[model samples]
Target: MVAGGGMGPDDEGISFAHALATLKEQGSALLVVGSVPEELFAKASRTMLGDPDADPPRRRLVVTPEPNPESAVRRLRETGPLSAEYARVISRGERARSAAVADSFDEMTPRTHVVDDSIRGLGTTIADVIEEFDLFAGGLEPAEFRMAFDCLPTVLATHGREVAFRFLHVVIAQARSVSGLVHFRLPRAVDSEAVGLFEPLFDATVELQVDGDDLHQRWHFRDRDITSDWLPVGDRP
Candidate 1:
């Protein structure tokens, strides 16, 4: 899982493109959960669909509670990986109203599900979250899917920590049953005691820190070796 402290501006530089690329190449389903949907899209664009000339995944599903899909497409086109290509694609599809259509490139567009929280008579309960996953991932092979839970803190805030924990427990089970990769992001600013509850849920923990032009990342494989390295932002790995 790609967990970050998100304590400062530098913390935003954390990159999980490598992980996403690996999972996609393995043909896995992906679940990305985040408070800010745009950031999630940008991450996917940079890593999973970074190669402007490469093909899009067969089933890249993105579910969000946000309303403006067009803004998401704009974010990807302006700042995501292959920004120039995304921009060109948007230019060509200027009249398209949906992000899936506007963001489509090289003939591949991810399936996007937008759950507007502002809608009347809508429920933002934990069950609603799980239901969305089921709708997108039901019957899909775990090995063929990779999911990202961008930030659980938001869920925790909406529903009590206990409820959020139970929800994740169920989600993780489904992911493991399908052998799909599950990546989660949690802010470091959360209570240390509460954060401990997530440790056993994840196999490994990764930390990313930005120092000047260099991005430093450390991986702690529980009960295994720890690896740390630095990468220059402008230089490709």
Candidate 2:
């Protein structure tokens, strides 16, 4: 893309040509971040298509690239671990954040919400949160981790509230397992009504579990870790 942008020769800067050549030798990703304006092209050639018009006759272009990422995630979650490809993609939080976020809708899905927002964004879901606690007696740290939804929220009350508990449960599951902090970075779409409900209540509740003490705690809801208001509690000063 750099060379294609026509980096000048006398500028002594490597053009997209050299960059592309080097990239071919050492395989790596070429991410074009944010967004770019759409370009128009003809079927004449691949490299040099039509120089897109500044403002062309805006005709319709029906191109079926693929279903939106949400559909793809729905299929992946439905398939479960059998959907290793999708899980693998999930494990790679960077590429998959967008997909996970889009599926943040509660009625539609919760598993993907746990995997993407709860796991990747908050840096929870893995036993590695505390950096030294290890289960499996391996002490090898968590190989890979995420909040896999064996079930959904029984009662969400509202969309935001559902998403909140959804986020909290995943962290509680992982935190109680080994050693880790429940870091809550609320999703942009967190139900506003539910936001205050939990936030003001439990933001200060945090501690380290040593010697499997969590196993004895009497938790409310699904498990003891189920918090009515984790983000608010965790976010307290």
Candidate 3:
């Protein structure tokens, strides 16, 4: 039985269509297919020939298989049988590593493990991590969440907003991942709306609602829409 795989996600899969396309790329070609189903032999003898065993008038019969176990084994044992003529493939393994490998190929993109570790190591509560990384929501104590939150900025800085946010959808463990509307309350008085705004790559919906003596506005990322529960941006501001 056919088991396992050997195709990458980018390659899609091995199919007759892809094989044909590869041939066309090389130039002129002709594909010949043959199968020895019982019905064809009977039909050819009766319809084309006046007699059951008679040969057809304008046709040549080139029997590909002699109806024997040896031929079947020979036909099936294909590793690179037609490598020069019609390229044959044995197996393909599929994996979701294309985006990651391609992204980091030129040293431009970060690795998958780097991203995964970044999120998981975020010092937030274990509950928060289980929520984000594990994609499950649970009650975590304040101290633990604070522990997890400590790693937020470093994680964001290293990962960047693009991949960071996509992963944060699971790693954030709170409303912040999607529509939770969270940010750092910059104590220095920057727009709270501007917390995760270092790069426009991340579609952060947080809006800063800075108010009086909020000179400490730079300390936390305030939600412009609400004046309550504004979290610290980097455990600092």
Q: Every model's Cα RMSD, please?
A: 10.3, 22.2, 31.7
Highest-lDDT candidate: 1
Candidate 1 per-residue lDDT over residues 1-237, each given as its tens digit: 333444333333333444434443443332222223344334433343233332332122222334334433443333333222122221112233365444445333333333332221122322343344445545544333333444365566766777767667766665565555545566452226665676666654544444553443444444333323443223211
Question: Model 3 — TM-score against the truth?
Answer: 0.23
lDDT at position 118, candidate 1: 26
For residues 112-196, what per-residue lDDT tens digits would candidate 2 score against the true structure?
Answer: 3223333334344333322322322243222122222211121232234657565555545544343221222221123244334
TM-score of predicted structure 2? 0.23
In order of appearance, the predictions have TM-scores of: 0.50, 0.23, 0.23
Which residues of candidate 2, in runs, are more than 4 Å off? Answer: 1-160, 187-193, 200-237
Clashes of 1: 13
Error of 1 at 44 (Å): 7.8
What overall lDDT goes with each candidate model? 0.40, 0.27, 0.25
Instruction: Give the least accurate 10-residue stretch of model 1, judged by summed lDDT.
Output: 85-94
